[model samples]
Target: MNQAPRQRMTAQARRQQLLTVAWQLVRQEGSAALTLGRVAEEAGVSKPVVYEHFTTRQGLLAALYKDFDSRQNALIDAAMAAAGDRLQDKAAVVASSYVNCVLTQGREIPDVLSSLDSTPELAAVKRQYQLDFIEKFRSWFAPFVAPSDIPLATMWGMLGAADAISNAVVAGDISQQEGMQELSALIITTIARCG
Candidate 1:
């Protein structure tokens, strides 16, 4: 006879738990290893349960992106708010928070970004958030650098670089200090517009 099912999990809680486990597995290994099979195995749930939670790998990836996007955006928002009406300080705050969110949150963020990086479909999902980041940056970065001076392109480049470095550090290919230097260089280039 089948064993009694484990205590039923509320849908929201179950989804959160699945995401928690999915990201953990990705953090430990890589996003490529974050399949329904692995998540089910890690979460102590069946594959069907994972399927019910996420429906597809894309869905799962999208949710993961959403989860971290919320976090990153909040940090950016708080920095902007705390910087008050001062323009230069706002960018500094935002840059510090964005960099810290990537460098400090470490693997959890890198995993989510990696999983969604290659999925062009997710660009549409990410675009809205990108716009929000830009608008916030624009207001903050506009004073010191002309609206035109802010390295919008380089801003994105910095984000990609930070994500890659985080993954590298987790995999032991790069030192955390190395990651910080590289990321700091990107930030400096974006802010200073170095050629």
Candidate 2:
């Protein structure tokens, strides 16, 4: 008996499909289950097909991080735009949006992100994303902050506080609402110190 040939997916479609499979596997079985072979099996594709999209495990992890980063930035941007002109409102909106994203990402994402950082390449990618976020925050908040008040270090600290708060939320150390409130207070206090 002969089997039917598989339908061919466009390059972009195939990449997206693999990424979805990878994320599902991570969510279902933790980050330890995210091998290329497992992803191919879960995705109903050949190992070579997965490899074609991501040359190595590190490449695959990097792609996932980039995808996550893009989605997160979009959410933050939308929230910030919809927020009031006041710095406190803007900060609360942004922090709430970010914490909401983390909460909705399923419990496995934080582990996957941590595991992905084991490699130097992946760690560098993570660091680069953090820097990009800091720059974006600096650009957005500059208008509301005093010129001499918000320096680069302060921007970096703000970003770190956001990440730490999100991590705490993910770790179940605090409720999402609490995390948002705490982060908002930090942001408001930081802004106040700027001028």
Candidate 3:
């Protein structure tokens, strides 16, 4: 009944491993349980290993958010490229991809997001990501609607709706089909109104 020795991993691989373990921890025990030491313990590495990657809890939280955002961006980019040139097709892709990304990550993201907003520094990081996402959305839909016609407020509103509807889907308040349909309609109508 001897335990096997741990295999060596490159620093980059180790960081990815730690992040994956950290996400699993958050999924099971919630974001409050996601301290660097906890991640180190769960990842079967020294605390310094986790510290080397994310020096602080805020740092770890920000990294988690960035990881999630990166995956979401990749999904949207791939789907958008495959989507038809029509506005409705683009809108549907956006809606389905956004919701599907959230659903794919399951319900843990909202907790991670709330944790990110707990501190001003982390909140700023989160806000910057949100702003970037809105800009990306604007650029994607700009072909259909004049950029100026959409207004910053409308973009923010659409983002809000996306977050709300996606969260509802994750929370089981609505079916995946219902959420995607409603979100797709919202995007199309919002762009139509702005145009």
Which candidate number has the best lDDT?
3
Across residues 84-166, which tens digit of lDDT does each residue of candidate 1 receive?
Answer: 55434554565456656666556776556656667787766677666776666555656656645655676576556655666
In candidate 2, what are the lDDT values of residues 66-166, reduced to their tens digit?
A: 88888988999988878888888888887898788878785766876787689888899888998998888777677766565478888888887887888
Cα displacement (Å) at residue 68, model 2: 0.8
For candidate 2, the 10 contiguous residues with the lowest summed lDDT are: 140-149
Output the TM-score of candidate 3. 0.95
Worst 10 residues of 3 by lDDT: 142-151
Tell me the tens digit of each residue's lDDT in model 3 across 1-195. Answer: 999996799989998999999999989999988899999999888999999999999999999999999999999999999999998999999999999999999988999999988999999999999999999999999988775557899999999999999999999999999999999999999999888
Clash number for every model?
0, 1, 0
TM-score pick, better of 1 and 2 = 2
The Cα RMSD of model 3 versus the native structure comes to: 2.1
Best by TM-score: 3
Q: Which stretches of candidate 3 lie over 4 Å from their true place?
A: 1-7
Q: TM-scores, in order shown?
A: 0.70, 0.91, 0.95
lDDT of 2: 0.85
